[model samples]
Target: MGAGIAAAGLSAVNWEKMLQIAASWIISPVLGGIIAAGFLWFIKVKIIYRDNKITAAKTWVPVLVGIMGGVFTSYLVLKGFKTLIKLNFSTALSVGFVAGVAIWLVMIPIVRGQAKGLENRNKSLKKLFSIPLIASAALLSFAHGANDVANAVGPLAAIVQATKSGDYGSAVTIPLWVMVIGAAGISFGLFLFGPKLIRVVGSQITKLNPMRAYCVALSAAVTVIVASWLGLPVSSTHIAVGAVFGVPKLIRVVGSQITKLNPMRAYCVALSAAVTVIVASWLGLPVSSTHIAVGAVFGVGFFREWDAVRRARRQRSEIVAPLAMPKEERRRRKLVRRSHVMTILAAWIITVPAAALLSAAIFWIIQLSMR
Candidate 1:
């Protein structure tokens, strides 16, 4: 009798796992793609392109194309992982993380080359060349979806696998439905909370002319892609932030123009987010990507503005009109000021815990229901 009961339970487990994977394949990608598209659209229309006619139109086209490309890249990466590595969840996650960092480090030079190429093409048009940025953003998004998408679906996959194998285990085949939910969650996160961060990133950190923006975006994307290919689970936020900072650093080093670069502020923001992630992981809590990315943006902005403030003060002492700078330059300076940083920082501090707690709660509820 005991043997018979054990056999029956094992059979049930296997069936459940199969069902879960089946569901996930059907749902996650579609949901993720749609949500990402909608959220990106909002950013283009409401914030980035708000009043600019030419920029807005060109921006949207790339964004739409990039999102689609990202979705496809994500699907391919995940499917490849499933087919190839066959590692358990913990191992896979570890591998992914390391790979991501390595990728980012290696891509730095390539990014420099791309930036140089753009500069050579047109000095004035260099700032407005956003095409490369959009392309790069798309790639980063693809890698992001490929690696992190697992986070949303992994548990469900485990649950399914456990059910099918008649053993409670961590590694399980992800089902279609679970994939859909995870993808949907990501999409929702991007749509609802992504814009503010995007604004901070796209506009605040540095005055990204189209060309500069393209360089940053492309470098970041390439970093993520290489990482994903290496099976690394790196943070898209980190890559995006790093690339944003990296571009300016490259410009200063290569261009040698004394344009202000705020390393301190950028470090603070990136460091804070990194610390938060470590703490959260240690404490068994989920950290928000949006929080970290936004924090970095604010950091760069604050330091830039702080430098500007000092410049204004020095000018005042010399009896020169502090407000004599070009309106565009002043506007850029104001955007980076300390006050703006604080506001954005406050937002970042709030988003992570809130989103994580919400996700955890929802996950718990779902588990309980399934039980």
Candidate 2:
């Protein structure tokens, strides 16, 4: 579409914006995975792995609910209802914090009530997550509609603007009716054809308990909000799929296989990466340094193991063994299906160029027919 428009002298392509979007396509999923894994780990350590699970849930679930409430409140104020009202980030954050505290106070008794009859088991814990998970899912759906509907109607809006004014600028005000149509079309299409895809994503690829589903839903919502704040275009599907893949197993693989990370080491990596990026930016360099952080992790892991072996050899002593899981057990414990991952990756790779080519072809045909 950009190609056709440029060829016809309709609009100049903003390659920089395109680059930002392409970068987002990569970053959003990784960010979602990181956030989801981090949140899930916190839940496990604070609540799931506790001796008194009911007690822990009663204590922590309200806090988690409050956090989610705050995020959603801030997001709505900042972006969701931007058309109806305007607010700055600081004000939005302030509102969110106050709302969050109120929610925390309200949920305390609710959580306690829910925990009254529950057993100290993971199954019983699922009940605690049910309400939050549903709310998160609803928030994710709203975010998805807000973000992806623009993708659907954006080109049509541009064409309408160009046809009316013959000035296809980078920005155009989308008509209200156009938005309604886009949203309605999305809902209608999903109602007709969404179930098969949902089945594949929901159950075929990986089985999701309420806990895992909550993480996936919240991660996707939070990722979309963050991406919107940064003016990046991201796919909700990608973020959700990435969150689904960001289970405890991935953390185990990274910590056990690539590197063993204590809290201090993890903090070091995060801080060093931030410092490096700040320095690079100060020096007037544009850099994406996620790979740099990853390299540091692997480098630290290898160096430590080598140093341990060297000291062991010099002292004629045994080196401490790394944690190990049996291969069969590991296979059985795997949460992600490799086949689905490969299929999804293949679709992602093919979809972009194919869609662009098809759009270009259709545009040319339309032009020819009009001529």
Candidate 3:
């Protein structure tokens, strides 16, 4: 959520870049949905109904492997060898592409052999992808750390620079204390709140098996990579959490809320919020990052609720699926916990306003004292 809001702040800094990112975010999922559905159709036509189990697995495995290869290769190219080698961006991209293709080709033989004669090959498809999924998650964590550690370093860097040079725009030197504090603060935060955040994300927001978790992590990594390449500021944390709200909202927390979170549609939720707040900020509105994130979360969910109600109104519309599962059916299987939703919504409602008002009062008091 913190990351989401910070990314939103970039719109205030530069709406043109932010909106361009907004376009990418919008197109990515739409195109992805079309491509995925088409791929599924292709499999049904070319592989699945044909009953050639051996060929099905072999064909799909390479595609998945190649995608994974491309993702990690791109990540490594961007940041993997900066300390060891200082290749320029284009060189790094070339190296990464070659590495990805090599890996994809190498995996074909391995995955082909592994998929031989499983009774439930379809169900086990994700199982075949499991190792790669875990690898992607690991890569994502490293990529996230590489990118998101900047959230801590950025303000500190600028502050240190300003204190020394009396100019916010000066070149900055990172002090040891700043580095220690940033690392220690993150460590402490993870120790303290990490478990709960992990629990809420893994168990509540979405049902996370190894495969689904890979979806969240992989999507985040790819999104962040795109953001970086575009020079857009983003928070990996926000993107990950936002990605969860995209699709397959399942309850996994034992005894918390069996209620469902088909609460929000997968596409358009995260980017919509970011773009909205960004446009507002550009118009000189004083918006809070926390507010934008929480609002986006709720707004998306509520939109889903409304979609459930209105899904039957139009038959030929592409915007809202008229053929989507009926709202009542969705309500039973995918009910969102009212308490869980409201608690965050309530906090989002007040936190920013209260903080701003209190700070204003304190500053006024100090001014009077000086007078």
Candidate 4:
């Protein structure tokens, strides 16, 4: 899309295509929110709030395996390598099956852990989810670097080609170094600008335990898969923030939070984010990973708060004397920090127009200078 836009001015860019992209900006986040919230509801009713969390947790383990395997496998098959690993539809399915089996194997011990010496045994078993969450984040990060690297290098490559060929339409070879520059840019961004934003996403929205984090990450992947199927033009980042979670928050691509993720959280978030990105690319919506990621965290935060409210109501009804609860405990859960969410939303809204205006100013300067 950047290459096309660079080769041709805005008039040359298809308005219909632009409209589709615009529609996705709205639809992507909404869709992502719905999917994520629905999944959380399922978890609460079936696992967290269920009478048999042990069995429920065990049951969901295999289902999550299928989800992760299928999502990642589809991602690899669709995107693994334009020039490297290739998997046809059937082959991809096979790989997914194998991954599912492997995940199940790993999950067994965690699910089957001895219930002895443990209070809230089901809660304890949930910790095993952190392992995959970390692994997924790593994969997401790698893919993000790969996909976004192209974004960084694309204009450079196009410019180089145009300069050499003296024609936007001419075929030209892309230098590998261009890609390296993009990757370097991402690494630099992470190293330099990541810390401040990581804190915002990690803790500000909600109290994210590993389980919630996993849901956020996994939902991002699932939404991308869904967007692909529906042929929607959603932003990569919107799906991420709406679909993904605090994992993206950790990597500095999404929201701000204080501490960095442990190795596991980092891994899962990055991998899931990358997969979400590739899926978005395949769908032709090269939306901002940062925006999507932030939205996803917000969605999770919002959902958590809603869930808390619902739980409170339920508990209140069951309690003989609801008024006996402490004042602090009686306070409504602030699942999401409204100020941060507003700030992030405002930034996303302004980004494109801000860039356009800046570009126009630069163009005006150039015209005066050339005169």
* Top of the candidates by TM-score: 4
Worst 10 residues of 3 by lDDT: 260-269
Q: Model 2: what TM-score?
A: 0.73
lDDT of 3 at 44: 36
Evaluation by TM-score, superior candidate among 2 and 3: 2
Better of 1 and 4 by TM-score: 4
Q: For each candidate, what TM-score against the reference?
A: 0.40, 0.73, 0.57, 0.75
Q: Candidate 2: give the clashing pairs.
A: none
Of 1 and 3, the candidate ahead on TM-score is 3
lDDT tens digits, residue span 299-370, model 1:
333434665677676877689655556777667666444444443344333433444455556656776899
Give lDDT: candidate 4, residue 196. Answer: 68
lDDT, each prediction: 0.40, 0.54, 0.45, 0.54
lDDT of 3: 0.45
Instruction: Point out the higher-scoring one by lDDT: 2 or 3.
Output: 2
What tens digits encode model 2's per-residue C-alpha lDDT throughout 145-262?
Answer: 6566766788789988899899878789888888999899879856754554343333433344455445545555555555555555544233232234443333333333433443
- Return the lDDT, model 4, position 271: 32
On a 0 to 1 TM-score scale, where does candidate 3 land against the true structure?
A: 0.57
lDDT of 1 at 215: 28
Candidate 4 residue-wise lDDT, 1-371, digit = tens: 33334435677666786677666566545544454455555656776676767667667755665566666766666555536876676776677777777877777776657433445544565465656566545544544454446545656898998888777763557888887777777788678646765554455544455555555555455445434434444443422233223334434434434222322232233333434444554455534444444444555556666776767867887876555545675454665666655645665565445555555666667668998
The per-residue C-alpha lDDT of model 3 at residue 346 equals 44
